[model samples]
Target: MEYFQHEWLERNLNWFEGVSKLIPSTNNALESFNRVIKDENTLRERLPLSRVVVVLINTWSLQYTANAKTVHAVPTLNLGLWTKAYQWATEKKKKIVSHVNSEGYVYFIPAGQSNEVTDLEETLNASFSTFEEFKTVAFSIWTTTIPNDSNKWIEGTCNCPGFFKKLICKHVVGIAIRLKYANPPAEAKSVPIGAKRRRGRPSKARQALLVQ
Candidate 1:
């Protein structure tokens, strides 16, 4: 990190004057940005990907200096995971069962591929005006699964047709937004243990096969 700072200093000799005015002469501005990035990811360990570093760079650059309300970069979590899943599923000749949980976790179930397992800790969360209202919104979003029927098994499995195409599907994003205000479980539960459940394949099997 220090090496990078020194390298940055060397490269910015010409821009030094303007850079100083924009940030500071302390040169610790990058460190502060890095700290913010760490907090955003909730990571306690070293980053596993150079892409993560790029994300941090972009996110901090925007938040600290760009003065933009929201950075329109790739989603730091879902999009990365989704791309990986799509790649794996394609390579191994498999499919993924994706759905939004009541708690707003986007569950990704790989059919015949992907060495990765479903992470109980999902990136999604819910939102609302108040905590109680948030919980209500969470419940509503979870309950609003497609087919417009009270089919728990069908919904849990994400068998609905319009799910994948709608990037920020109403039911899914709604629950996720609600989760922002809801209290989290004090003790994390282990992987859900119950009867094995399957909710059939996508109608877009051809589309799934073409994903590369």
Candidate 2:
């Protein structure tokens, strides 16, 4: 309780708040793209600025062209980017439903209303911890208003570390699943079939040989 009150609660309490505008809450797409860059020699090794620019331009061009094609083929659910989030939310649904069956009740409150103290046991059982130093702080599932819109409650929030850091948590996922089915995001624009690909960087070995 002390660990939660002092450290975990304070830092992650509002992580899940105000996520209505987001589809998955997590930036997995961006992370995956970064991982691809890291896996390639582009970012792992120190290269000349010119080479770096070439590598980035090439990569971005390929991705942009591929994304354009994908969007054209399928125009729903952010071009299937939300697939993982949907799966995650589905799994959490089972757990939450089971928990509700056993526990009898799980409190659901509006996003900003969590400040009002209440019975802690009534909250969702979404607390988790990787370190022994801190006590696990259970998250309370709450409904959040969509960003730039006050009349809609399409967003959800939780007080979990996952939600705080990556903007994803079981509680938030559960809400997302329902919201996504009810209303999907707008379709992405497709790339032209004959889009031009970026040119590759000059070979350093060839440049060195030419100089010699």
Best by lDDT: 2
Candidate 1 lDDT, 17-133, residue by residue in tens: 322221233447479657766777535457668878787677766766767645533222243223332332234332333455453335343322243334323412532344566
The C-alpha lDDT values of all candidates are 0.37, 0.43
Model 2 C-alpha lDDT per residue in residues 1-212, reported as the tens digit of each score:
65765575686665544434334556787897678777874757868889978987887778788884244221133333243344434432222321232322233532322444344354443344443322323233342222222222223334544444544444443354554533322221122222322244323353345654
Mind sharing the TM-score for model 2?
Answer: 0.33
For TM-score, the strongest prediction is: 2
For model 1, name the residue pairs that clash.
125-176, 126-176, 126-177, 126-178, 126-179, 126-180, 127-177, 127-178, 127-179
Q: Report residue 154 deviation for candidate 1 (angstroms).
A: 61
Number of backbone collisions per candidate: 9, 1
Q: Candidate 1 at 1: error in angstroms?
A: 38
Span of ten consecutive residues with least summed lDDT in model 2: 184-193
The TM-scores, one per candidate, come to 0.17, 0.33
Off by over 4 Å in 2: 1-35, 41-44, 66-154, 175-212
